[model samples]
Structures are given as C-alpha cells and as structure tokens.
Target: MFLLSTILYDKNHVLQNNILTTLRHVLSNITMAKNEKHSVKLRIWFYSGENKVLGKGRIELLERIKETGSISSAAKGMKMSYRQAWQMVEEMNEFSKLPLVEKQLGGKSGGGTKVTEAGERAIIAFHTLENKVNAFTVKEAEKLKF
Candidate 1:
C-alpha cells in the first residue's frame, strides 16, 4: 500500500544528496502485507532479548475487548475464536510488566473482560506510534526506490 502510494510522492518530497539517496535506497526494500478489500496493513516480526515488538494484533484485540466489554465478544468482533483471544491475552500478560486486559468475576450479569486503563493507554500509544513509524518507513523507502 505504501509502496503504491510512493510512486506519486517523489515529486512532493524529493531529496538530492548522498545521505538522502542512501536513505531512499534502504527504504525501497521495506514491505508490508496489506488487504486489498479494506486497506488494512499487517506487520509481523519477532524480537530478541531486548524484546522489540512488531505487528498490531494484540493491541487491536485489546481494543475490541474494551469496546465489547467481554473477551468472547471481542474475539467474535475480531473474527477469532475465544480460545485464540484468550491465548493472546495470556501471552501478552506473561511478557509485559503490565497486563493488558482485566477480567471481572461473575455477578448477576456474569463475568466479562475489560481493558485496564493501562491497556487502553497501551492501545492508544501503540497505534499512534505505529502510524508514525510506518509513515517514516514509507517515506524513507521512497527515498531509496529511485
């Protein structure tokens, strides 16, 4: 998607130096998986000991839980099974200092899942940073493509 958009940006942000030229060369190689029907982009990657992260699946999942007020409902909203959603939340809990989703015990209406304030903050920060970095990457790639 970004690659496709870049063909039209060169005239808008062209840089003309070896540093910028080298930067462009590097950016041209960046790639992302995108859906044609919805213009959604997916990024997947692994991290080493320092624990860098990639992709937005977990964050989005948490947002859904917050929106629907239940893990099962969130999973359904995301088109994933309940088991899958639970596993994701579990894995995130194991790795992070903060737990992303919180669950309530049963009452008259039964129990439900909710995003903690921390979780909501994480969602907002993760998405905001992702948009910025992905845009930077795209622009850098544009420099390289020529």
Candidate 2:
C-alpha cells in the first residue's frame, strides 16, 4: 500500500467564537509541541515516461489487429492514426525486449498484423495484474479520510 500525505484544513464548523477559543487554546498550549498541518499533497505518478508506461494502448491495438484483419482497421477502431499506433507498438516492443506483433506481407490474402505468442503473454500480464494492482490501490485510498 502507498502512504500518501496531504494538507488538510478544518473549516466546516468555523465561527468567530470558535476561532477565538481555538486561538486561546493554542496560546495556552504554546509550550506544547503542536502537530503541524500538512501544507502540500504528495501524489506519485508511477509511470512518468513514454517507455515506462505499460502500453495498454499498444496491447489493445495488437489485440484488435489480431481480432480484425488489418492494422489500419485496428488503428481506425482505436481512433488513432496508423502511424501513431505503429509508433506505440514499436516503443512497447523495445521496452519489453520482445516482438509483440508480426506482419504478413502482400498476397491475395492481403498484408496484415498479428500478435505473437510473446504479445499474448504481455497483454495478459499487463491487463490482469495491472488492473488488480490499481483496484487494490483505489480501495486503500478509499480507506483513508485525513
């Protein structure tokens, strides 16, 4: 579980009398060590890079290409340019050190792309495990109030 910290203020029941009373209490307890309010929220983005991202988009593209008949068709279905999807595929292939897709050249059957065995492995690992991790993190976050 991740321990995230954030600044918090209690203004829900604020009133003039409450403010004065709080100030008096603080002044009376001046010698006591006060727990300072957090002044900033610290949020960590796990993947902060092109290569670092788990390439779920590339996985979906590969899956779609495998299901459909063409890379162009998959890109269109994903609402992405073929060139952009191709670039993402290249990046993921490099990041994973595995060729996640293969191409068949022109013929009467037509040229198209398919996910390799390694690609299938990657898609399963990414979607299943990453989803579990995210769900756990979300549940943990929901458990925290202040």
Candidate 3:
C-alpha cells in the first residue's frame, strides 16, 4: 500500500511539473509574439533640385534658433558646436528661396539672431507634412500581417 502511494505521488509530481513547464513555454511564446510585431518608420528631407536642403535636424535647429534668439545658444542646446550650427544655417540660407535666418548687429543691448518669415513657414510646413505622413503610415501599419 505504501509503495503504491509513493509511486502515485511521484507520478503526480512529475505531471504537475510538466504542466507548469508547458504553461511557461506557451506564455513566453505569447509574450514574444506580442513584442515581435512589425512597425513602420520613415525619414523625410526637402531638396533643391539635386541638393538636399532640410530635414529633421535642420528643422529642430531652426526651431531652437527661433526660441533662443542666439545661434550659439541654440547650438549649445543641441549639443553641437557653434561653427557646425553656423554652417548649417549658411547651407539652409543658400538652399532656401528666402534667407531662413538673419543676424542682428550689436547695439546697446546685444547682437542676436532671428528666424525670418520664410523660416517660420518652413517649420510649420515641415511639421504639417510630417504629421500627415505619420498618420498615413500608422493607418497602413495596421494592415501588416507579419
């Protein structure tokens, strides 16, 4: 009788362990499947004929310049050097139909930078287009199977 009971207890223990292991495996697979879902991503840039003009980084830099009123301050905020920021501004000015930024001469207060009307329009246009593209991509992402 004791032997029969011991044999039954061992078999029950093994069966429980097997069930638990199988449950763990299934749960892990479900979690992995959830995490492995496909998504879409994109980057956008404006060009002047064959020359690349503006993109995310330049737009952000323009925004920073607009906010701070100083190119050096904007560069510092972006963790970039002043020279690099200046070069970007120069490139943008060259590519744009109107100069995107202008320098104000020093006076009683101090010299500063400012974004022109065109720069503001460019910023708004880029954000609007980016939002539209993002919305389209999100809607399309729903159709993905794998």
Backbone clash count for every predicted candidate, in the order shown: 4, 0, 0
For candidate 3, give the lDDT of residue 14.
73
TM-score of 3: 0.71
Q: lDDT by residue for model 2 over 15-119, one digit each (tens)?
A: 555666766777868955475543332222214354553455666787898898678889999999999877776666666666777877897568887888987
Every candidate's CA RMSD: 15.1, 13.7, 11.0
What overall lDDT, based on C-alpha atoms, would model 1 receive against the true structure? 0.69
State model 3's lDDT. 0.86
Model 1 residue 31 lDDT?
38
How do all models score by TM-score? 0.62, 0.59, 0.71
Worst 10 residues of 3 by lDDT: 1-10
Better of 1 and 3 by TM-score: 3
Clashing pairs in 2: none
Candidate 3 residue-wise lDDT, 42-61, digit = tens: 98998888776789999999
Residue 44, candidate 3: how far off, in angstroms? 0.7
Among all candidates shown, the one with the greatest lDDT: 3
In model 1, which runs have C-alpha deviations exceeding 4 angstroms? 1-54
lDDT of each: 0.69, 0.67, 0.86
Candidate achieving the largest TM-score: 3
